[model samples]
Target: MSQELIQAVMVLTKQKGFAPEVIFESLEAALLQAYRKEPHSNPDAYVELNRETGAYKVMAKKQVVETVEFPETEISLLDARKIDKRYEIGDIVEADVTPANFGRSAAHTAKQMLIQRLKEAERSVVYEEYYSREGDIITGVITRVEGKNVYINLGKTEAILPPTEQIATETYHEGDRIKCYIVEVKKTTKGPQIMISRTHPGLLKRLFELEVPEIFEGVVELKSVAREPGMRSKIAVYSRDENIDPVGAC
Candidate 1:
Protein backbone atom coordinates (compact mmCIF):
# COMPACT_ATOMS: atom_id res chain seq x y z
CA MET A 1 0.00 0.00 0.00
CA SER A 2 1.09 3.54 -0.72
CA GLN A 3 1.48 6.21 1.97
CA GLU A 4 -1.47 8.17 0.55
CA LEU A 5 -3.76 5.12 0.69
CA ILE A 6 -2.65 4.34 4.22
CA GLN A 7 -3.42 7.88 5.34
CA ALA A 8 -6.85 7.71 3.76
CA VAL A 9 -7.54 4.43 5.53
CA MET A 10 -6.53 5.94 8.87
CA VAL A 11 -8.81 8.94 8.40
CA LEU A 12 -11.75 6.78 7.35
CA THR A 13 -11.29 4.39 10.25
CA LYS A 14 -11.23 7.30 12.68
CA GLN A 15 -14.34 8.76 11.13
CA LYS A 16 -16.06 5.38 11.40
CA GLY A 17 -15.01 5.02 15.08
CA PHE A 18 -12.96 1.90 14.40
CA ALA A 19 -9.76 1.19 16.34
CA PRO A 20 -6.48 0.85 14.45
CA GLU A 21 -5.85 -2.68 15.69
CA VAL A 22 -9.34 -3.80 14.63
CA ILE A 23 -8.86 -2.27 11.19
CA PHE A 24 -5.56 -4.06 10.81
CA GLU A 25 -7.10 -7.36 11.86
CA SER A 26 -9.94 -6.95 9.37
CA LEU A 27 -7.51 -6.16 6.57
CA GLU A 28 -5.24 -9.05 7.42
CA ALA A 29 -8.18 -11.47 7.45
CA ALA A 30 -9.36 -10.10 4.11
CA LEU A 31 -5.88 -10.47 2.61
CA LEU A 32 -5.57 -14.07 3.80
CA GLN A 33 -8.94 -14.93 2.27
CA ALA A 34 -7.98 -13.26 -1.01
CA TYR A 35 -4.71 -15.12 -1.15
CA ARG A 36 -6.48 -18.43 -0.67
CA LYS A 37 -8.88 -17.73 -3.55
CA GLU A 38 -6.13 -17.18 -6.12
CA PRO A 39 -5.39 -19.87 -8.68
CA HIS A 40 -1.80 -20.61 -7.55
CA SER A 41 -2.30 -19.82 -3.84
CA ASN A 42 -1.03 -22.02 -1.05
CA PRO A 43 -3.27 -23.55 1.57
CA ASP A 44 -1.00 -22.50 4.44
CA ALA A 45 -0.90 -18.86 3.35
CA TYR A 46 -0.77 -15.92 5.79
CA VAL A 47 -0.82 -12.12 5.60
CA GLU A 48 1.80 -9.70 6.91
CA LEU A 49 1.34 -5.94 7.21
CA ASN A 50 4.19 -3.46 7.70
CA ARG A 51 2.72 -0.75 9.92
CA GLU A 52 5.60 1.68 9.43
CA THR A 53 5.91 1.41 5.66
CA GLY A 54 2.23 0.64 4.89
CA ALA A 55 3.38 -2.40 2.92
CA TYR A 56 1.71 -5.82 3.12
CA LYS A 57 2.71 -9.29 1.93
CA VAL A 58 0.69 -12.41 1.26
CA MET A 59 2.89 -15.49 1.58
CA ALA A 60 2.96 -19.09 2.77
CA LYS A 61 4.59 -20.13 6.05
CA LYS A 62 6.29 -23.41 5.34
CA GLN A 63 8.57 -25.58 7.46
CA VAL A 64 11.88 -26.61 5.90
CA VAL A 65 12.23 -30.45 5.81
CA GLU A 66 14.78 -32.91 4.35
CA THR A 67 12.14 -34.38 2.05
CA VAL A 68 9.08 -32.31 0.95
CA GLU A 69 6.02 -34.50 1.58
CA PHE A 70 3.48 -31.65 1.83
CA PRO A 71 4.75 -28.93 -0.51
CA GLU A 72 2.17 -26.41 0.64
CA THR A 73 3.13 -26.64 4.31
CA GLU A 74 6.68 -27.96 4.09
CA ILE A 75 9.47 -26.88 1.72
CA SER A 76 12.63 -28.85 0.83
CA LEU A 77 15.71 -27.78 2.81
CA LEU A 78 17.63 -27.32 -0.45
CA ASP A 79 14.93 -25.05 -1.87
CA ALA A 80 14.66 -23.05 1.39
CA ARG A 81 18.44 -22.59 1.53
CA LYS A 82 18.35 -21.09 -1.99
CA ILE A 83 16.34 -18.16 -0.61
CA ASP A 84 18.32 -17.93 2.64
CA LYS A 85 21.47 -19.86 3.46
CA ARG A 86 20.68 -20.03 7.22
CA TYR A 87 17.47 -22.07 6.66
CA GLU A 88 17.86 -25.43 8.42
CA ILE A 89 15.81 -28.64 8.18
CA GLY A 90 13.49 -27.67 11.04
CA ASP A 91 13.41 -23.95 10.34
CA ILE A 92 10.35 -22.16 9.08
CA VAL A 93 10.42 -19.99 5.96
CA GLU A 94 7.99 -17.45 4.49
CA ALA A 95 7.81 -17.92 0.73
CA ASP A 96 6.28 -14.91 -1.06
CA VAL A 97 3.31 -16.07 -3.13
CA THR A 98 1.91 -12.58 -3.71
CA PRO A 99 0.56 -12.14 -7.21
CA ALA A 100 1.88 -9.64 -9.72
CA ASN A 101 0.19 -6.20 -9.32
CA PHE A 102 -2.31 -7.30 -6.66
CA GLY A 103 -3.25 -3.67 -6.13
CA ARG A 104 -5.75 -3.66 -8.99
CA SER A 105 -8.52 -6.20 -8.31
CA ALA A 106 -7.33 -7.29 -4.89
CA ALA A 107 -7.18 -3.73 -3.60
CA HIS A 108 -10.77 -3.09 -4.69
CA THR A 109 -11.91 -6.28 -3.01
CA ALA A 110 -10.06 -5.35 0.17
CA LYS A 111 -11.74 -1.94 0.32
CA GLN A 112 -15.15 -3.56 -0.06
CA MET A 113 -14.35 -6.08 2.65
CA LEU A 114 -13.23 -3.32 5.02
CA ILE A 115 -16.43 -1.34 4.45
CA GLN A 116 -18.60 -4.41 5.09
CA ARG A 117 -16.76 -5.22 8.30
CA LEU A 118 -16.97 -1.62 9.46
CA LYS A 119 -20.76 -1.63 8.97
CA GLU A 120 -21.07 -4.80 11.03
CA ALA A 121 -18.94 -3.23 13.74
CA GLU A 122 -21.12 -0.13 13.72
CA ARG A 123 -24.29 -2.21 14.05
CA SER A 124 -22.80 -4.09 16.99
CA VAL A 125 -21.97 -0.83 18.69
CA VAL A 126 -25.49 0.52 18.23
CA TYR A 127 -27.01 -2.70 19.55
CA GLU A 128 -24.89 -2.60 22.70
CA GLU A 129 -25.59 1.07 23.28
CA TYR A 130 -29.37 0.79 23.01
CA TYR A 131 -29.48 -2.59 24.72
CA SER A 132 -28.21 -0.98 27.90
CA ARG A 133 -30.98 1.64 27.66
CA GLU A 134 -33.76 -0.93 27.70
CA GLY A 135 -36.72 0.22 29.89
CA ASP A 136 -35.48 3.78 29.53
CA ILE A 137 -36.99 6.69 27.62
CA ILE A 138 -35.62 7.94 24.31
CA THR A 139 -36.58 10.95 22.25
CA GLY A 140 -37.01 10.42 18.54
CA VAL A 141 -38.67 11.93 15.48
CA ILE A 142 -41.28 10.12 13.50
CA THR A 143 -39.66 9.48 10.15
CA ARG A 144 -42.01 7.05 8.44
CA VAL A 145 -45.58 5.86 8.90
CA GLU A 146 -46.90 2.60 7.41
CA GLY A 147 -50.57 2.35 8.29
CA LYS A 148 -50.46 0.74 11.76
CA ASN A 149 -46.69 0.84 12.22
CA VAL A 150 -44.42 3.83 12.70
CA TYR A 151 -40.65 4.25 12.44
CA ILE A 152 -38.81 6.74 14.60
CA ASN A 153 -35.31 8.06 13.93
CA LEU A 154 -33.21 7.98 17.07
CA GLY A 155 -30.05 9.46 15.56
CA LYS A 156 -27.84 6.37 15.04
CA THR A 157 -30.66 3.86 14.52
CA GLU A 158 -34.35 3.69 13.80
CA ALA A 159 -36.91 2.11 16.13
CA ILE A 160 -40.24 0.48 15.43
CA LEU A 161 -43.41 1.63 17.27
CA PRO A 162 -46.10 -0.89 16.57
CA PRO A 163 -49.79 0.03 16.76
CA THR A 164 -50.19 -2.27 19.72
CA GLU A 165 -47.62 -0.28 21.67
CA GLN A 166 -48.73 3.16 20.55
CA ILE A 167 -50.98 5.38 22.66
CA ALA A 168 -54.62 5.05 21.70
CA THR A 169 -55.21 8.76 21.39
CA GLU A 170 -51.91 9.50 19.57
CA THR A 171 -52.00 9.96 15.82
CA TYR A 172 -48.36 9.98 14.79
CA HIS A 173 -47.11 11.66 11.62
CA GLU A 174 -43.77 12.48 10.04
CA GLY A 175 -41.55 14.94 11.92
CA ASP A 176 -43.40 14.51 15.20
CA ARG A 177 -41.21 14.63 18.26
CA ILE A 178 -42.10 11.67 20.47
CA LYS A 179 -40.72 10.09 23.62
CA CYS A 180 -40.85 6.32 23.90
CA TYR A 181 -39.62 3.56 26.15
CA ILE A 182 -37.22 1.00 24.70
CA VAL A 183 -39.07 -2.24 25.32
CA GLU A 184 -36.72 -4.49 23.39
CA VAL A 185 -33.69 -4.45 21.10
CA LYS A 186 -32.87 -7.22 18.67
CA LYS A 187 -29.77 -7.94 16.59
CA THR A 188 -30.93 -8.58 13.04
CA THR A 189 -29.00 -9.25 9.85
CA LYS A 190 -29.95 -5.88 8.35
CA GLY A 191 -29.29 -3.93 11.54
CA PRO A 192 -30.40 -3.48 15.15
CA GLN A 193 -34.17 -3.71 15.42
CA ILE A 194 -35.54 -1.78 18.39
CA MET A 195 -39.06 -2.05 19.76
CA ILE A 196 -40.28 1.17 21.32
CA SER A 197 -43.55 1.84 23.13
CA ARG A 198 -45.39 5.01 24.05
CA THR A 199 -48.20 3.29 25.99
CA HIS A 200 -45.95 1.42 28.41
CA PRO A 201 -46.10 2.27 32.13
CA GLY A 202 -42.33 2.56 32.03
CA LEU A 203 -42.67 5.48 29.63
CA LEU A 204 -44.83 7.35 32.13
CA LYS A 205 -42.39 6.62 34.92
CA ARG A 206 -39.46 7.83 32.85
CA LEU A 207 -41.36 10.94 31.81
CA PHE A 208 -41.94 11.79 35.46
CA GLU A 209 -38.21 11.50 36.15
CA LEU A 210 -37.54 13.91 33.33
CA GLU A 211 -40.32 16.36 34.14
CA VAL A 212 -39.98 16.42 37.95
CA PRO A 213 -36.77 17.83 39.34
CA GLU A 214 -37.33 16.13 42.71
CA ILE A 215 -37.42 12.68 41.11
CA PHE A 216 -34.35 13.36 39.00
CA GLU A 217 -32.38 14.69 41.97
CA GLY A 218 -33.27 11.57 44.07
CA VAL A 219 -35.22 13.62 46.62
CA VAL A 220 -38.38 11.79 45.62
CA GLU A 221 -38.65 8.03 45.19
CA LEU A 222 -41.08 6.87 42.53
CA LYS A 223 -42.68 3.63 43.72
CA SER A 224 -44.98 2.46 40.92
CA VAL A 225 -47.00 3.51 37.88
CA ALA A 226 -50.19 2.21 36.27
CA ARG A 227 -51.52 3.58 33.00
CA GLU A 228 -54.49 2.94 30.73
CA PRO A 229 -52.30 4.23 27.86
CA GLY A 230 -53.85 7.47 26.50
CA MET A 231 -56.73 7.72 28.94
CA ARG A 232 -55.61 7.87 32.58
CA SER A 233 -52.56 7.02 34.68
CA LYS A 234 -51.79 6.66 38.40
CA ILE A 235 -48.38 7.07 40.08
CA ALA A 236 -47.17 6.32 43.64
CA VAL A 237 -44.40 8.51 44.98
CA TYR A 238 -42.82 9.37 48.32
CA SER A 239 -40.20 11.81 49.52
CA ARG A 240 -37.01 10.58 51.16
CA ASP A 241 -36.69 13.78 53.21
CA GLU A 242 -39.19 15.35 55.69
CA ASN A 243 -39.72 18.72 53.94
CA ILE A 244 -40.12 17.50 50.35
CA ASP A 245 -43.63 16.64 49.05
CA PRO A 246 -43.42 14.22 46.12
CA VAL A 247 -47.15 14.28 45.27
CA GLY A 248 -47.24 18.07 45.01
CA ALA A 249 -44.02 18.17 42.94
CA CYS A 250 -45.48 15.92 40.23
Candidate 2:
Protein backbone atom coordinates (compact mmCIF):
# COMPACT_ATOMS: atom_id res chain seq x y z
CA MET A 1 0.00 0.00 0.00
CA SER A 2 1.43 3.36 -1.07
CA GLN A 3 0.27 6.87 -0.17
CA GLU A 4 0.79 7.84 -3.82
CA LEU A 5 -1.68 5.23 -5.04
CA ILE A 6 -4.22 6.29 -2.39
CA GLN A 7 -4.02 9.92 -3.51
CA ALA A 8 -4.33 8.88 -7.17
CA VAL A 9 -7.44 6.79 -6.45
CA MET A 10 -8.98 9.73 -4.50
CA VAL A 11 -8.51 12.02 -7.50
CA LEU A 12 -9.90 9.40 -9.87
CA THR A 13 -12.98 8.93 -7.67
CA LYS A 14 -13.79 12.62 -8.12
CA GLN A 15 -13.15 12.65 -11.88
CA LYS A 16 -15.19 9.51 -12.57
CA GLY A 17 -18.10 10.56 -10.34
CA PHE A 18 -17.85 7.34 -8.35
CA ALA A 19 -17.73 6.78 -4.63
CA PRO A 20 -14.73 5.09 -3.02
CA GLU A 21 -16.70 1.90 -2.45
CA VAL A 22 -17.75 1.70 -6.09
CA ILE A 23 -14.19 2.00 -7.36
CA PHE A 24 -13.12 -0.71 -4.96
CA GLU A 25 -15.93 -2.99 -6.15
CA SER A 26 -15.02 -2.46 -9.78
CA LEU A 27 -11.36 -3.11 -9.05
CA GLU A 28 -12.17 -6.30 -7.20
CA ALA A 29 -14.23 -7.67 -10.07
CA ALA A 30 -11.56 -6.75 -12.58
CA LEU A 31 -8.80 -8.34 -10.53
CA LEU A 32 -10.79 -11.54 -10.15
CA GLN A 33 -11.37 -11.74 -13.87
CA ALA A 34 -7.70 -11.11 -14.52
CA TYR A 35 -6.74 -13.90 -12.16
CA ARG A 36 -9.14 -16.29 -13.93
CA LYS A 37 -7.47 -15.61 -17.27
CA GLU A 38 -4.18 -17.02 -16.04
CA PRO A 39 -3.29 -20.62 -17.01
CA HIS A 40 -3.08 -21.65 -13.35
CA SER A 41 -5.96 -19.43 -12.29
CA ASN A 42 -8.32 -20.91 -9.73
CA PRO A 43 -12.10 -20.73 -9.94
CA ASP A 44 -12.21 -20.01 -6.19
CA ALA A 45 -9.95 -17.00 -6.61
CA TYR A 46 -11.29 -13.66 -5.38
CA VAL A 47 -9.98 -10.15 -4.95
CA GLU A 48 -10.21 -7.58 -2.19
CA LEU A 49 -9.08 -3.98 -1.77
CA ASN A 50 -7.67 -2.08 1.17
CA ARG A 51 -10.21 0.72 1.52
CA GLU A 52 -7.84 3.19 3.21
CA THR A 53 -4.59 2.44 1.34
CA GLY A 54 -5.98 1.76 -2.17
CA ALA A 55 -4.02 -1.50 -2.29
CA TYR A 56 -5.64 -4.60 -3.82
CA LYS A 57 -4.96 -8.30 -3.38
CA VAL A 58 -5.90 -11.27 -5.55
CA MET A 59 -6.35 -14.34 -3.37
CA ALA A 60 -7.22 -17.99 -3.92
CA LYS A 61 -9.26 -19.53 -1.09
CA LYS A 62 -8.31 -23.14 -0.46
CA GLN A 63 -9.71 -25.48 2.15
CA VAL A 64 -7.05 -27.13 4.30
CA VAL A 65 -7.47 -30.90 4.24
CA GLU A 66 -5.44 -34.03 5.14
CA THR A 67 -5.29 -34.95 1.44
CA VAL A 68 -5.38 -32.39 -1.40
CA GLU A 69 -7.64 -34.08 -3.95
CA PHE A 70 -8.27 -30.78 -5.79
CA PRO A 71 -5.13 -28.64 -5.76
CA GLU A 72 -7.08 -25.60 -6.88
CA THR A 73 -9.49 -25.68 -3.95
CA GLU A 74 -7.73 -27.76 -1.29
CA ILE A 75 -4.36 -27.47 0.38
CA SER A 76 -2.64 -30.15 2.45
CA LEU A 77 -2.82 -29.46 6.20
CA LEU A 78 0.95 -29.88 6.45
CA ASP A 79 1.53 -27.28 3.70
CA ALA A 80 -1.00 -24.87 5.26
CA ARG A 81 0.63 -25.32 8.70
CA LYS A 82 3.99 -24.37 7.16
CA ILE A 83 2.51 -21.00 6.12
CA ASP A 84 0.55 -20.50 9.35
CA LYS A 85 0.99 -22.68 12.49
CA ARG A 86 -2.69 -22.20 13.46
CA TYR A 87 -3.98 -23.83 10.26
CA GLU A 88 -5.88 -27.13 10.73
CA ILE A 89 -7.94 -29.45 8.55
CA GLY A 90 -11.23 -27.88 7.30
CA ASP A 91 -9.81 -24.36 7.77
CA ILE A 92 -9.89 -21.95 4.84
CA VAL A 93 -6.56 -20.49 3.78
CA GLU A 94 -6.08 -17.45 1.55
CA ALA A 95 -3.08 -17.23 -0.79
CA ASP A 96 -1.97 -13.67 -1.53
CA VAL A 97 -1.12 -13.37 -5.25
CA THR A 98 -1.63 -9.71 -6.04
CA PRO A 99 -1.01 -9.54 -9.79
CA ALA A 100 0.76 -6.17 -9.91
CA ASN A 101 3.34 -7.34 -7.35
CA PHE A 102 3.76 -10.81 -8.86
CA GLY A 103 3.16 -10.75 -12.62
CA ARG A 104 2.91 -8.50 -15.72
CA SER A 105 0.25 -10.17 -17.93
CA ALA A 106 -2.28 -10.44 -15.09
CA ALA A 107 -1.85 -6.74 -14.27
CA HIS A 108 -2.49 -5.78 -17.89
CA THR A 109 -5.63 -7.88 -17.99
CA ALA A 110 -6.97 -6.20 -14.85
CA LYS A 111 -6.22 -2.75 -16.23
CA GLN A 112 -8.23 -3.43 -19.40
CA MET A 113 -11.19 -4.75 -17.42
CA LEU A 114 -11.18 -1.69 -15.15
CA ILE A 115 -11.19 0.64 -18.15
CA GLN A 116 -14.33 -1.03 -19.57
CA ARG A 117 -16.18 -0.80 -16.25
CA LEU A 118 -15.40 2.92 -15.97
CA LYS A 119 -16.77 3.60 -19.46
CA GLU A 120 -20.05 1.83 -18.69
CA ALA A 121 -20.38 3.76 -15.43
CA GLU A 122 -19.98 7.05 -17.30
CA ARG A 123 -22.74 6.09 -19.75
CA SER A 124 -25.10 5.21 -16.89
CA VAL A 125 -24.58 8.67 -15.39
CA VAL A 126 -25.53 10.36 -18.67
CA TYR A 127 -28.61 8.16 -19.16
CA GLU A 128 -29.99 8.81 -15.66
CA GLU A 129 -29.40 12.57 -15.89
CA TYR A 130 -31.27 13.13 -19.19
CA TYR A 131 -33.97 10.62 -18.27
CA SER A 132 -34.85 12.77 -15.25
CA ARG A 133 -35.31 15.86 -17.51
CA GLU A 134 -37.64 14.07 -19.92
CA GLY A 135 -40.78 16.02 -20.87
CA ASP A 136 -38.95 19.32 -20.31
CA ILE A 137 -37.84 22.02 -22.76
CA ILE A 138 -34.28 22.60 -23.94
CA THR A 139 -32.82 24.96 -26.51
CA GLY A 140 -30.46 23.43 -29.04
CA VAL A 141 -28.87 24.33 -32.33
CA ILE A 142 -29.96 22.68 -35.54
CA THR A 143 -26.95 20.72 -36.69
CA ARG A 144 -28.40 19.06 -39.79
CA VAL A 145 -31.60 18.29 -41.62
CA GLU A 146 -31.81 15.08 -43.69
CA GLY A 147 -35.01 14.06 -45.35
CA LYS A 148 -37.68 14.45 -42.64
CA ASN A 149 -35.35 14.22 -39.61
CA VAL A 150 -33.71 17.20 -37.97
CA TYR A 151 -30.66 16.72 -35.74
CA ILE A 152 -30.27 19.02 -32.77
CA ASN A 153 -27.10 19.59 -30.78
CA LEU A 154 -27.82 19.56 -27.04
CA GLY A 155 -24.20 20.23 -25.92
CA LYS A 156 -23.54 16.83 -24.33
CA THR A 157 -25.25 14.90 -27.14
CA GLU A 158 -27.47 15.18 -30.18
CA ALA A 159 -31.24 14.75 -30.19
CA ILE A 160 -33.51 13.80 -33.08
CA LEU A 161 -36.41 16.04 -34.12
CA PRO A 162 -38.60 13.93 -36.39
CA PRO A 163 -40.60 15.62 -39.17
CA THR A 164 -43.92 15.19 -37.40
CA GLU A 165 -42.61 17.27 -34.49
CA GLN A 166 -41.15 20.10 -36.59
CA ILE A 167 -42.93 23.37 -37.25
CA ALA A 168 -44.24 23.56 -40.81
CA THR A 169 -43.89 27.36 -41.02
CA GLU A 170 -40.43 27.64 -39.40
CA THR A 171 -37.43 27.46 -41.70
CA TYR A 172 -34.59 25.35 -40.23
CA HIS A 173 -30.95 25.79 -41.13
CA GLU A 174 -27.64 24.74 -39.70
CA GLY A 175 -26.64 26.56 -36.49
CA ASP A 176 -30.15 27.95 -35.96
CA ARG A 177 -31.11 28.00 -32.29
CA ILE A 178 -34.55 26.67 -31.43
CA LYS A 179 -36.45 25.66 -28.35
CA CYS A 180 -37.89 22.16 -28.37
CA TYR A 181 -39.68 20.11 -25.75
CA ILE A 182 -38.16 16.74 -24.88
CA VAL A 183 -40.90 14.29 -25.70
CA GLU A 184 -38.90 11.28 -24.58
CA VAL A 185 -35.42 10.20 -23.49
CA LYS A 186 -34.78 6.63 -24.52
CA LYS A 187 -31.77 4.36 -24.02
CA THR A 188 -30.89 2.52 -27.24
CA THR A 189 -27.98 0.41 -28.52
CA LYS A 190 -26.53 3.57 -30.05
CA GLY A 191 -26.78 5.42 -26.72
CA PRO A 192 -29.34 8.01 -25.48
CA GLN A 193 -31.96 9.10 -27.98
CA ILE A 194 -33.47 12.44 -26.92
CA MET A 195 -36.62 12.95 -28.98
CA ILE A 196 -37.48 16.63 -29.21
CA SER A 197 -40.66 18.17 -30.57
CA ARG A 198 -41.65 21.65 -31.81
CA THR A 199 -45.29 20.83 -32.56
CA HIS A 200 -46.39 18.78 -29.54
CA PRO A 201 -49.22 20.41 -27.56
CA GLY A 202 -47.18 19.95 -24.41
CA LEU A 203 -44.71 22.50 -25.75
CA LEU A 204 -47.29 25.27 -25.67
CA LYS A 205 -48.51 24.18 -22.27
CA ARG A 206 -44.98 24.20 -20.93
CA LEU A 207 -44.32 27.63 -22.39
CA PHE A 208 -47.33 29.08 -20.60
CA GLU A 209 -46.40 27.26 -17.44
CA LEU A 210 -42.98 28.91 -17.63
CA GLU A 211 -44.13 32.39 -18.61
CA VAL A 212 -47.25 32.65 -16.49
CA PRO A 213 -46.57 32.35 -12.77
CA GLU A 214 -50.27 32.24 -11.94
CA ILE A 215 -50.72 28.76 -13.44
CA PHE A 216 -47.64 27.52 -11.60
CA GLU A 217 -48.71 29.06 -8.28
CA GLY A 218 -52.28 27.69 -8.40
CA VAL A 219 -53.73 31.23 -8.69
CA VAL A 220 -55.26 30.12 -12.02
CA GLU A 221 -56.04 26.67 -13.36
CA LEU A 222 -55.50 25.59 -16.96
CA LYS A 223 -58.71 23.84 -18.03
CA SER A 224 -57.93 22.50 -21.55
CA VAL A 225 -56.03 23.28 -24.73
CA ALA A 226 -56.77 22.91 -28.47
CA ARG A 227 -53.99 23.41 -30.98
CA GLU A 228 -53.25 23.52 -34.73
CA PRO A 229 -49.58 23.56 -33.65
CA GLY A 230 -47.19 26.38 -34.58
CA MET A 231 -50.14 28.26 -35.97
CA ARG A 232 -53.51 28.37 -34.19
CA SER A 233 -54.13 27.30 -30.62
CA LYS A 234 -56.58 28.14 -27.81
CA ILE A 235 -56.08 27.52 -24.10
CA ALA A 236 -58.90 27.77 -21.54
CA VAL A 237 -58.07 29.23 -18.16
CA TYR A 238 -60.12 29.63 -14.97
CA SER A 239 -59.43 31.68 -11.89
CA ARG A 240 -59.16 29.70 -8.71
CA ASP A 241 -60.40 32.80 -6.85
CA GLU A 242 -63.07 34.99 -8.49
CA ASN A 243 -61.13 38.16 -7.67
CA ILE A 244 -58.27 37.27 -10.02
CA ASP A 245 -58.84 37.46 -13.80
CA PRO A 246 -57.20 34.38 -15.38
CA VAL A 247 -57.44 35.53 -19.02
CA GLY A 248 -56.15 39.01 -18.19
CA ALA A 249 -53.29 37.65 -16.12
CA CYS A 250 -52.20 35.28 -18.95
Off by over 4 Å in 2: 1-24, 50-54, 97-103
Worst 10 residues of 2 by lDDT: 97-106
lDDT of 2 by residue, 1-250 (tens): 3465467568778777678776678778887887787666677778777788766667888899998888777889898988899998899999765544444565677678877886777667677878898878889999998988889898767888888888888888999999999888888766777888998888888888889999889889888878897689999999988999999989
Q: After TM-score superposition, what is the CA distance of residue 40 in candidate 2 from its true location, in Å?
A: 4.5
lDDT of each: 0.85, 0.80
TM-score of each: 0.84, 0.81
* Best candidate, lDDT: 1
Could you give candidate 1's per-residue lDDT for residues 125-194 as a string of tens digits?
Answer: 8999999999999999999999899999998888889989988887988999988899999999998889
Top candidate (TM-score) = 1
Model 1 lDDT at residue 52:
61
Worst 10 residues of 1 by lDDT: 32-41
TM-score of 1: 0.84
**Shift in Å, residue 81, candidate 1:** 4.1
Candidate 1 local lDDT, residue 14: 76
